[model samples]
Target: MAIVKMEKMHLLALKSEQSKLMQTLQKTGIVEVIDITGDKKEEEKQGHKEDRIRDEIAKELAELETKLNNLKLGIDFLKPYSKSPNPLIYGKPDVKKDELSKILSNETKIAESLQRVFDLDKKIAQLKSEESKILNQIDFLIPWQGLDIPLEQLGNTDRTAFVAVVIPRKSKDKLEEKAKESQLPLDIKVIGEKRDDLYALIVYHRGYNEDIQSLFKEFSVTIQDFMGLKGTPNDIIEQSKRRLSDIQKEREDIKTQAQGMNQDLFNFEVLYDYYMVEKDRKTNTLKLFDTDKSFYLQAWLPKERKSYITDTISKITDMVYVEFTEPEENDDIPVLLSNSKLVEPFEVITELYSLPDPRGIDPNPYMAPFYWLFFGMMLSDAGYGIILSLFTAVALLKFKLEGSGRKFVSMFFLCGISTIIWGAIFGGWFGDLIKIKPLWINPLDNPMSVLILSFILGIIQIFTGIILNGYKNIRAGNTADAIMDQGLWLVLLTGLLMFAIQPLAGIAKYVALFGAIGLILTQGRAQKNPIMKLASGVMSLYSVTGYLSDLLSYSRLLALGLTTGVIATVINTMAKTVGGSAIGFVVMILILLGGHVFNILINILGAYVHSSRLQYIEFFSKFYDSGGRAFDPLRIKTTYVKLEDL
Candidate 1:
């Protein structure tokens, strides 16, 4: 329910045992390594030049990173062919320590498999490129297949020249008439017509080539080239088609081969994770400094794990020296939150906003109940609640969701329970479908009551925030600030609220006057000029409107709650109106199911967003001081496999 306490750690160990020490600390997963190698000023201040000594592991780390990348590429290539386990059912596959070692022992085989996959990918790429060119050649040949002369024979002779041209059909007659007028020793044979073009083979005497070319150019004819092609169009087309069939067969064979390597996919995954862990270990070494005989390291660890970490390091080497000290007031300490399992899920809410200050309180325990209440109130539908609860319950039990994933689902599960309670209270069981009597007042019949209840709830939350702020101020020994600022505001707000009650109306005015006078005196006490101070104090009273606005924001609770009920009722009414005949009844059932599903999805999103908005805007504004960095410790980080002890 609070930020975990941390302590600074300085360690000295033999240079030879540095690797062992790092491995031990990494397995403990409790230390955040820091680089002291570049702290020249600190080293000079301490008069310990030994701290400046640093080791270079960049080359080794880079090599390991390259290996990891290759392994990742191989795994991705094989994923589609592999029988991957469903994350919903199996989560991440776990690799035992012994199993990891066994997999690594066969590293030679895995490397060969990876190389094979790479080669196959390269070969397939080349084959596809070749297939594209062949298909284009076939397209060109298909339009000229009627020509009988071989392509090589269409080049030239000493006395005669051969050429192929395609000219627009509208200009064919004109070109022929022009050729006749020129009387050039040329003959044009129309091989075939395709679309708007006429494909023709033209033979002309070499001496009259220029004249024939001029005649052809009059029609905007396009000359065709089949350079170095030896066979006729039909023969070439047949050969290219056969080659295409072969390319297809070869591609299929390559795919089959790649699929056969699916069993080795896990091996690739394990090796990738192995390299990744090694890379992390090596990368952290950059934060360390080493001498000829010894090495120096600095880190921060949780106070609670001090004994455990020290003991683990002691077992690794007896020549090691370790010291721990309290963090300085100005130290930029990383924050790690600790909370009970029941309250843990709501930490996601705070994190989504921002991490709380290390010196401040964890807001999860305080904000969870209000968020749960608000979310349920907004979504208030018993049927939807039951469905949400059951679905999330199954997901939580079946899937090994980790980190924020698990927290979000668990939060929703709890919200579902709250929704069910509120729905039952309001007598809303799927919008009057079950005919259940009201356990409380229905918002539709008397919205004013629900509206009042929402404002009251909002007031309670706002007051709670102010109280927490006062507590924080008191903890920091600013008792006067707490009372003058927070205490007086609470007094004024509470007194003003009391004036609405019949029994307390007589005393409420006096209480309100005292609170207002106190605020007017204290709010601007820091102002030096008398006139300015009085004016500032008077103006401070105007902020009551902000609090009033905050209270009004709770109107959304009633609005959303009523919206859900009204929409559900509309869906039911529309269904009944059409459910008179057999076909209509079928459509009615579909409409009910689909409409409710859509309604649930849309409203759930709304409830989450609006509920979170209230907390961030109205509640947290009073006390939360954010902007703390998260704690990151050195541990085995694997993507495909969760490492476990055998």
Candidate 2:
């Protein structure tokens, strides 16, 4: 594993040729454009405006961004209706060179189609709003269907005042008594009842209005207003039902029309990618410095891509100037990992933690083996391993996964293989559902053996990390630090282990003492005071406890490994208990299926989390130097389609 070497790039081209050159660079997809004009305003503040070029593409970029947003909205609107292929099965739609060119030239067709979709979406929105209002009206009117008078006719006449009131069913009798006491021309009619309230219409003489109004308020009356409605309750409900039916039909028609334009959705995606390419070019163009007739561009790119970029640009225009130079020590060089196909998937682990420093060693190749072993041991079930391997293998073969998605699937596929191996070694096939002889030791029968194995693996990995740290120090010309730090620790640990052997006990004591003396003398060499140096060196021995704690973390491997097998065994036992009759057999099958699936899912999560913990906390902490920025170049990035030519 290695970090790809990078070089600084300087480019000068005619202002007229800027667009063409940018297009070329984007297609190459290697150059990371540097923003040299970042301090334009600062320079202007200092009264040096002659060297500044007015941002020519800013307005165009803004317009393009707006158009892109609208286009994206249109696509999202139609996505529910379109019969798009499943991304998991088909990946992004691929457009060949001729197809792309054809779609690019037919911009008018796509624009018209997008407008039509937008119009239909707007229509649907309006229809939905109308539908909501009609539904509400229908609900309100259904409770008043017994009211015979039209809503408009319920208003006051010349002699009497008419008002619709709703009061509690228990308050109805009190209102009747109050109306009787008023001795006015007050008529109260119970029109309808809903829940705990009665809908009533009250008509009273205007001369008795104050008395009738007071009685109405004292009876807990709620006045209903249908002032904007023209028809009776029954008439309004019927009309609303008819309108709802019509709205439903109209919405269905719109959905049908939108679904019919799914082909245009694909074309819209192509045009989106085209605009994206253009937008990126314009964005990077702002990073350049321009004069009256020429522009200057600076970038960083992989050193190996130098010849390819130079040749490609030279073919386009011979007048352009290009230069490449070694990156300076202080330059913020971006990190790109390069590894073998087998080791590549493990890069996702390092990436999730952080990319390794450009000047340090790549840890993927070293950390991957331990991660694989740990994951397999944690999920040691042959049947589940087979399923994982087959599923991931099929996905890798049938689906076009890219970037982290591809790496993740690939990693699980390899981990599945490791699981199979460990499963066989531990004699764990579906947790003893199938009778098989032990290839090695059954962890359930002899857990201590497996615990010892986990500890040994942890010790080996720890030593590997320390050696890698030593390598990094040696590479950086810090041999003294490597010997005093990594070398002495290894010696001490090795001697401690040797103490377990009877024959080496005598030598082990001296070996351990020598390592301790060396660390005590050198670990505090940076301190100035002699007394402080001795105290610091004495304190350094406490780190052995930290190392012991890290080593203990590996026991999770045995713990989780046992957890998977034990749970599988419990499921099998439960399933067996239910199996006697034909129906019982069916129940047993269901239990086995559901239980094993759940067990696999839960343990897989545990394995992944714990496995990564070992790497990040135990392994990487020893040697990994993070904080390098990832490489992000100006290139054609698309969401819905892949450009075959590019």
Candidate 3:
């Protein structure tokens, strides 16, 4: 049965009667103009005002963001000098009043010290980069390929940071012994009393594996704990003493501000709030229609489609008691404007989420079938289908995403499964060996079957449309005429398909010939249009070519499936041939990896596009209405503050 998507008029009126229409609209979260374009503006005296708290907080957050940006700039300016080559000492945060004052009064010294420390880091990083370049070159050889070893087992995990340690200061003798055994050269430095330890910092001259902890453990480096003293910078002390005074003043200002809100500042904010608000403000009204009741009925239609009112609303029902009049003129305002021909999908999704209670059911309940069918047909490759469905399944299970991305992903998963079934029926196992005998003939070898199937599907969906039209007619209280006009068309199309005009033979043709007669007599029965009526009836026959062409398009789905499988097969074949030569083994492996990856990427894209095309043309045309506004409530929104909180 075709679905009717209409609400009972009287019930809809009841919903709008109690609350302010403007408030309900504002709550929708759509960007809207504040001007009272219509007479539905809020009543200022009663005070059911929109929440300003969130907006105010949002404004304050924006200002804070600007200030934070400036603060970052100031901090960045002092960074270069603070990162000089000398290391800086870390002191405990000052707790005593005098000690805290002293540190605050020496911002120049602090900034300078910090810069020198950064400089030291840069120097060390540069040295390490050079050392690693040489190591990488040496490791390019096969013998060093699996030589990653750990240093932690040698007991060195707790040190601040150590590059490399040569063992035994006099390891000259020990190193000589090791060199003799391994045929490897070593350079060791003597250190400590009596030069008993022949250890030198190897500068980790090789790159520090960025994954140092793993490297330490892997290299089996022993950490006998740290032994070095904290390094001091003797050269920077004089410079720090000379630059203290000017920075001290700036530091004190920063300190005072960080100490939190004072009474005067808090009072100033309250005063500012008072200065901005008015104790008495006038009200605004948005009156859509104000007049004595009569035969007229006002519709809150898609404001853009107001021009099509007479045609759409008039045909939907048979209530002579109600009539629609033109909306009263108003100044131009920016808002969605559309005539009845078409509405975008975004708007359709939106409408589904909102809309009040209705007598006629929403069309959404019926579109699911056409949607699923088209989705499956477009994505009809078992291989891509399996991947798409499984990927979406994992995402859905692991995380809850929302809005367009979520809906799109969900659609892909659904269509993918459908594609899998279609692929199976077509005997398309990623273009595996073509089957000679299958439950359904493959699209490649048997194009005629797919064409016929496509036609059958079109007929089925069109029949569904006809049935729904009949239901809409009957629901309007013209049960007999609904059957005559709508039911007659269904029988007419069925006769054309089944009887084929040949079976009807002579006298039997008389029954099939009644379609136009029925339309001429009954179509627009309220208005006289005999010739035009018959013409409208003939329009149904115009579908011969549309049906032919659209059905042919379905074969593309088969073509795409074939492409995905054929390409993968070709890649494998070429790669295997290349691998046959002794010297070509590695090259063949690379070719195999590169070819399959490329094929998978391209096929995935093709599957997505083909699948999407089916939904848009075949399924959506079947009754997939897509112009509803989505319902969204207010949400807690934050950007930087929460991210920076820690």
Candidate 4:
């Protein structure tokens, strides 16, 4: 399987049939409408009229989108307390198209329901704020409750000023003695004594205020005032407590009312899906050309589906004209990959790098086997593999995950199986819990062997990349260039590899020498001057060092595999060290479970990152023709509901 072929399509329809035609195409969800209006000059030349009907449709769609967003916000706010039958269930409630129309027509009622929830939220916030203020005031007034005078009457008299002060408790008697000695017209009344301070009220003639302030300042005194408060401190405190109780009750009532509207969440979901479809239909029309009585549209669709699309459009209306043509060689055709189900999950990895150019080969099928093997080798734990597989299996079966989400989980599920296989081969059954011997040597016992295996696999992947590049060149009718660029290097590397082995050294030396001479003579064939060509060929031979480095990059696979086993074994050893008394055994169980789980999580992450790095940096850098645009079909993008086929 490779990139799916695409064909350009042009359609002409009467203005009256435009809406029906667009609806049909959107429902089919296979075509990608090309933006003909992107070029200002081309748009000016065409001079297409802006249809008022489309403008009105756009306005309506915008309003609908806003309404949907508001409704969703309200639904999300209430969801935690909604008490659904099964919160883990993923599918949205189904509703017919006509029922959706009916719901939309009653937009006023839905808006009112959403507004009610919003109003309650706002009121609850205000009530909470008020409650906090009241509680703080009560705490503050509790310290001043012993004063018998009303706070507002503290300075009511024109001739007298009243002030509250806190002085060190030990100095209360001294302050009284000093006040009497000063002979100021002031009344000193000690209200209360806290741990380290005495609360007092001082009433003095207005004229003696400055003198009294000076006297108090001489002995460190903090002035406390409850300004703008009416009635006695105790009365005010009681009143605030009552108000706080009322606010709490009101807040609870508002919460109950908001929770009661949770059933409307389903309605909101339906409307959200409805607006999404409507928005897509309106937005797609912007790419169309419109006249007073007709509309012209252009799009791209899969070539294999041309007949099906034609038949579907014909069924919609015979008045519309459709034409399909092959895309040109130089055209920027969108890429849509086609692969067997087994290989499809790895497309997630390829897509993250870049889509293959329409003219280039799809790399997913080529990279899948290697990626799976690398992931397994890095993780290399049978127990972790079983856990990972089960976790993903439950998620896949329990949820309706789609698109990238579904592919990602499926990829991990497959990787888990690969991990299990590698684990069994390497004798990693939960870090030697099972006494079964390894089919292959354990990395801990013989790390050099594992490292050698990593390099060997790396060499194979590199060779595969080179072979694929050569194949691509051959298909493009550049056999000479392909041989010089890929084939010569392949031969040279193979010869060198053979020469490294003791048995083939004698024959391999001559083979490598022959390949080296061929590369030196032919690598710069396109150059004009002999000296420059030969110099360039000599420089090209230096890339052998790069190839060697790429081979060494795979050593991380062995490193990670060993790291996982060593950490797991450490966890087991720690668990065993603590196993003595009953309490010690229980502690050992806790430590073993938590430590192993944490180790598994950390190792799995390391395995995924390192494995992906090898593929992306070492493998894909070879021959991937990136920068192709992804195929984005005109389709319904639902947020809450999946639309069933009509």
Candidate 5:
């Protein structure tokens, strides 16, 4: 709540003491420093470099993850076609990076091969689908001995609706006589038609298949002519598979080569890791010589370690540099390198839910508890609360999420806790599961009681913020403002407002007049100018309305609670009706699942958003600097490979 005053440190320290302080500060973080004056540039450069390294690591990890995703899909698809149900058992449990890269390359090539095969497969399938239609059309032409449909004319060509049987033009009248008596089994499109001498051009289908090649071959002579140029699709398909196999074998060899390189890369990385630690231990170590970094340490360690080196080191170390101050503030909070602010509670929950990433920002300390309370308020049904807690626990324990999924699940858990309490108060759980109805009517049944409780809660929370603000302000040495502008004024105004609108208690009348007079007098001194100060006093009196406004805004809590209970009641009634019949029972199951899920989602969102609004507008307006930087400690951050385990 309050910032602790830092005792001005002056100290003569052993080289070791300064180093320990630096390490301590590193653990806490850089952002907590009001000012960093010495060797700032080097620190900045180191920080940037660290960030870049982390980014590179992230990029590589993302590539690995993507490859893993593709492999998963490929594995799923190829499962039935595979040599065994467990391809993983056929090989090593983990693939080396180089081998993985090669595998990915081959995976791409194989996918392309599959595409080629699929396209051919599509053509073949379509040909098979059209088999009956083509056969039916050509059925009549089958018995025509030398009436001759040439295999070469099998594709696209036009035909006249009827051909005259005459050998010369003089026999055209005979053709017309034959046409009048016969009909041709044909498909035609008449291109041109005339009246006196009917003229026409027509269109029809010509079918081709490889099986027909042998029957049509009698029309040709030489070996080249006998074969013609018929391309069979099966031959192409087999050839593609062969090429794919060859490519796969080639990829295997490349993988073998890459496997050898993997060791070299690993060794290089391990060696680099050792070098970094060694270098950090050396260059950044404290020395007896005066340095710019404003840190020194004093400790009551055993006097034996300061033996022969102590006297000589004292000559180089400043003679006037010793001071004693008790530790505060940072002692309790666990420090990390990436802390940037009062890390939100939401972020903390995220950390709890997911695998910790070194580079991630923690917002959990700030956001979680409030977020939970807000969520509970939004969905004030006990049944929903119990449901949320169980569901979240199952999900978080079962199939864990890596990033924001973890945060949300954690948030639900916290919300569930709050909801349980509120639900008990509101007589929730399908309207009192244990017949533990609320002492007072539920928010739905008694709106006034709900509003009154909401206001009281709001007042308590608001005052809590004010008290915290006063503490911080006074500690930060803004005494005048803490007393006049913040603390005194808030107390006075809140007191007056509470007393003015109450089931007037014993001291209500006395408290209101005292609070009002104090507010009017103190608020008058806020401005330096006489005229402005006078007007400020006048506004202070009018600010009774402002107090009313703040108190009234809390009614939204009731509104939200009412909204949840009403929605649940509707769902419950619907579920009862649906459970009446067999079909209805099935529908009820779906409705309950879907409706409750939707309700949970919507209410959770509403609670969080509205709660945050109150905190920012009503609560935080009291006193929150929100400008303090988070403590950051310099350290290696890793996820997949646990360091202690390693």
Candidate 6:
């Protein structure tokens, strides 16, 4: 597997054929048009009026975008009242091109329906707001129900002034005694008493209004007034209740109308996709160079698709000129990965790091095996594996997932299979529940073996990366640099590893010595000063520490594997300890189910994160060249409905 080969394409066509050619290209969805008019000198030489054409296309695109946005807003407003489909069911509704055309032709009718729904929603919201205000007023007036006088008339009298006030229950007696001691002409009547305050109505002649105000200030009484209210408390309460009922009924009627407009939602979706397709088509046209009566375009196409594209263009028009040539050596070509189906899912990981350089090799196939092994080793449990595999399998089967979604689910499915294999080898079926004999040593019993295995795997991956780097160098005709930079280290590192083991120490020392001498001689060959060259070569030996650190990092695999088993065993023991009675058994079942599910989720996340970390930081550091741009082809971009081929 490698990066797909691409050819640079140049096309010239008459203005009459430009629209037909663009439409065909968009439908084919394989050509990534590039603008050729870069500098003012080139634009003047070509005499192309791209700016005006671009402005026209941009205006059309903007209008389409506005229409699409309005349709989306309408859909969101009606969604609450409409019948929602099952969320787990994925994939856009398939609509034929003719059907989409029909929907577009009825755009005015659709817009009217959306406007109607929007107006109804606005009215319903206003009614609900009014209803809420009335309900709050009803609550506030509940304690004042006993008052028989109109609220407005309480404080409005030519001869006498009236006020409703609430005084703290504890201070009411003292205030009344003080008022009597002053021989005030205030006529006070207790209206209502809540837990903390006594509501009272006070009436006085207009001449004593000042005295009544001063008495209220001394007692810290709060005067209550309902501004602009003309009816008694009970009368207003009945009117508010009736108004709330009417508003609620109006809202229900609006909701019913919205429910009946569900068919409009489907129509809106089709139109949204149609407009999106048109918008993208118009946007792509901006990339073309246009003259007064002709247009020219450049693109990069897959080498294999050149024939198909040529045939399609020939069918469109015979007046167009198309030429394809190999990309220049210095061309910054976009990269598209080519891989077998089994290796494809791992491309997601590669893309996350960054796509491989167009000239560089695809790393997905190389990285897939290591990623699979690492994930399974970190989350080693057969039961958890079974659950993960089954879940992803169902999702893959039930939904028509595309692009990154399909790759993500498929990658996890493969990881689950690996987990099952490792779990079976370790004899871990839900933390010792099955008690089957292990094909390999149990990590819990002999963790040192597992740790050694992890280190061995790490060493293999790191060395594999170095070897791949060497291969790349060889292909680039830099064999000496490859040998000096990577081959010497491969030998030296292998010797160091062998020397660490007691059995190979006698043979390994000499091998390491030879590698060291070779590195000293060749690692700093470019330095002219002899002493500086030797010093540089000596300093280069320090990179062994980086390799050592990378190898030690794999110890996490053993650590995580042990943690999963221990937590699972603890869950099992806790469940069994409380499972002696009937009720206890039910509790135990719940604990067993929920506890294991939680454990699986946490460990799975850890596995994915750490596994990706190793790939990104440790393994890919050896040979990957990032920063390649992705291939973006002209195509129909839809939101709600999937359009059939035109």
Worst lDDT 10-window in candidate 4: 40-49
Per-model C-alpha RMSD: 4.1, 2.8, 21.0, 3.4, 14.4, 2.9
TM-score, structure 4 vs. true: 0.90
Residue lDDT tens for model 2, 94-184: 8999999998888888899999988998998899899999999888888889988889888778987889889899998888886777676
lDDT digits (tens) for residues 523-559 of candidate 4 = 8788999998999888889999999999999999999
Best by TM-score: 2
**Separate clash counts for every candidate:** 0, 0, 56, 0, 23, 0
**Candidate 4 local accuracy as lDDT?**
0.84
lDDT of 2 at 297: 94
Q: Which stretches of candidate 1 lie over 4 Å from their true place?
A: 41-56, 131-245, 644-646
As for TM-score, the candidate ahead, 4 or 6, is 6
Model 6 CA lDDT for position 346: 84
TM-scores vs. true structure, each candidate? 0.87, 0.93, 0.44, 0.90, 0.51, 0.92
lDDT of each: 0.88, 0.89, 0.44, 0.84, 0.49, 0.86
Among all candidates shown, the one with the greatest lDDT: 2
Give residue 233's lDDT in candidate 5 (0 to 100).
23
For candidate 3, the clash count comes to 56
At residue 278, candidate 2 shows an lDDT of 83
| Model 1 lDDT, full chain set | 0.88
TM-score of structure candidate 1: 0.87
Q: Write the candidate numbers in order of decreasing lDDT.
A: 2, 1, 6, 4, 5, 3
